[model samples]
Target: MAEFSTNDSTNFSYPRSDYVEIVVVRHGETAWNAISRIQGQLDVELNETGRQQAAAVGDRLSKESKLSVIYSSDLQRASETAQIIASRCGGVEVVKDADLRERHLGDLQGLVYHEMAKTNPNAYKAFVSKNEDMEIPGGGESLVQLFDRSTSALLRIGMKHIGERVVVVTHGGFIRSLYKRACPNGRPAGKVLNTSVSVFHLHVEDKWVLKMWGDVSHLSQTGFLQSGFGGDRTSG
Candidate 1:
């Protein structure tokens, strides 16, 4: 059970190199996001504003550093964001990884946030309770499941691209999970805004150094900076 603990890093391994710098970017806003609806595993596309946000972030990254490759969730929102970023980064290759997907909310998918209590009380309760092992009713996964899947996938990618900087286009839920892993003391970190960029450096023996968290400066000048959609909590 400790293996699933957010505080435990013993379950995962890292590369032998000095470090791998990972620039984690949350996918831009979506239609569902505008309505506070739970997208979960649904393949929602980015809205017009989202596309703009992606381009803005891509431009920022292209100028900041050279990316070795882009790893993205197979979902359209993330993949499309990655594609847009690739084009800006001189056509860097984009690799889709299913493990990078948002946590599957099962029955909660597509339900508006405020209406969750009336629509699916039990599942909604489990979600807000933040119980690590309380899997949502229907087919949703537990916090532990997401933690294991995302961390493992990230480790694998870090190993493959040691010493190189890479961009990960993934969901907010996945980003939050890694935040907990990196900040075991649970210090309050601000919201993970759409297209926000966070930086993590992975070193040997499963060590991770969080260089930055939830940066949306790229969106500020572009007028895309805004609040996050629902599911900003540990669950999605």
Candidate 2:
């Protein structure tokens, strides 16, 4: 895994405090996530396990820090997760933004990986190769498109918050894109576990320093491991 370091400067002025913190939380597990389906742009709700994950996330955040604002993807899963966090953090209003939605999977929207590999070998290969230039067979987004839009949305949010501590609930792909930009030399070091929390401190110094990534200490008691699409759900 790649090593990461934190910024130690206190000379920057954030909108609210000495440091501006942005916490990124991935939404909990969903039926699609459990069933290995391509859930991109699908408005799926959290299952019972998902709700429990959200509750655990909420409890963890409530005990750890105070948040100024909570934002989330407009999708039901992300929105619901944000709501849980907001409720735990003093009933703060939750803001939903479409820009935070997962990358559109196009023709691959509902197919599982094994199915896609058998039915659309070319598309499967391109996807696995992480080709930024490859487009989805039907109408899926290229990696470049997802990166551009997601980063733009994040910049807009960062500008608004400036120095405030905010929480953003989004999908694994969205968070991965952000991490790639923040650490462009190589792939992000860790997996984005379900309901995992990562912290980034955006500074006026024109740098985004990662404080933590994929922290799942809170889920230890739950005995659940991170699960993703493309395989049977199981502990990691």
Candidate 3:
């Protein structure tokens, strides 16, 4: 195992003050993650390194946040990551929620970027271009739908547990959507890292503030962070 240091730093301008904090974590890697395949709602399990990353995130956060409850996507990979983190959090309750799952790609599930392009060039192009309203050919939700659904769920969570700290384990696409929603004026945030922690606070004014994004120190410390996968087309 690679030795990791506790350095959680970022370049966001979100203020740190008295408010309800929510730690948003993108689930650790899976086989599809390495290959840049669209998992969508496929329920793929995490790989060995993913499990290690989950443990690392759990270890890192146990001392960092005053965790109250854990909300996780019902998908296997995300649920597994939440379980690991909860185990490290001294038995924090893990609640499964399908709303936190990856955007359903409909028929695009399990396909890589190249494959998707060949099959549905227009939809693939629109998705790769980050067309917020582009819909997949076979019953897929657009990026707008994804952001609306996931953020709404998170907003409810924030409202229900004011002044409390919680952890949400979910997928990359949904993570990106929520971040985009929180920082509407921000530029594209590139990739949503596996096992990375993004923090948001529910302000007294009831607005969502992005405190941090893609803090991958745990994965870096544990040597689980890697690169070189092709870009995602459908972004599921």
Candidate 4:
């Protein structure tokens, strides 16, 4: 977690207490995700189970207070999830932004990891090794590119909702990207379950801070406590 406050000659007053609480929710499962394929920019709709997941998340969020704004990736899956949440919150408007979309997978768009590994050993190896500079052959984004775009989207959201509680519905990869950025030197091992919530506290002083992460208590009530999708569960 980065320090949220820093003093400078400009004399910007940093909020002493937590001002803005950003809740990040990954969109429900998609067909591509179920098959273990690299989705990237490829558009895929949520399965029926995913719709149920989103509804559950909406039900949970509807009970919370101080929900000011709802933002989501323009991708159908994310937008649909945001819409479900908004519908539960008395028809709150959902703001869509393309910047929040998942990292462009380029050439790896629809390929499964196992297939890619067997066909493109070097590329698969580089990805598994977390090589920031290695680009997937034919297409696919490098790790650095994913980080840049993900962080840019987060910063934009942070600025837009400076002192409010904003809900962001995005992809698992997008959330994972932020985690990697926040814990650069640490081993990257965190899963973003469908409808899981990650909270971050942003201060204007210096850098944004991660307050809480991967809270899936809402799903526990439904007897679904596992991270990510359990198996080849498809969405509508």
lDDT of each: 0.80, 0.73, 0.76, 0.70
Q: On residues 122-193, what C-alpha lDDT tens digit does candidate 4 reach at each position?
A: 656655554577766566667777778888888777776676677899987788777665555655436678
Off by over 4 Å in 2: 1-3, 6-19, 230-236
Give the clash count for model 1: 0
Task: Report the lDDT tens digits of candidate 2 across residue range 53-154.
Answer: 888888888865566788899999999989987887789779999999988776667787558778777666656654587777677777888788877887
Model 1 whole-model lDDT (C-alpha atoms):
0.80
Worst 10 residues of 2 by lDDT: 227-236
Q: For residues 60-154, write the lDDT of model 3, one tens digit per residue.
A: 88877568899999999999999999999899999999888888776777778558779777666656665778777677788888888988988
lDDT of 2: 0.73
Off by over 4 Å in 1: 1-17, 230-236
Candidate 4: which stretches are off by over 4 Å? 1-18, 120-126, 185-187, 221-236
True lDDT of residue 132, candidate 1: 85
Ranking by lDDT: 1, 3, 2, 4
**Model 4 TM-score relative to the real fold:** 0.82
How would you encode candidate 1's per-residue C-alpha lDDT over 1-236 as one tens digit per residue? 00122222222234325878788999988888877789988999999889999999999898776788999999999999999999999999999999999998878898987798899999988787756888888898888898888889888998888867889999888888777777766576556788988887777667777777877878876565345753435333
Worst 10 residues of 1 by lDDT: 1-10
How do the candidates rank by TM-score, highest first?
A: 1, 2, 3, 4
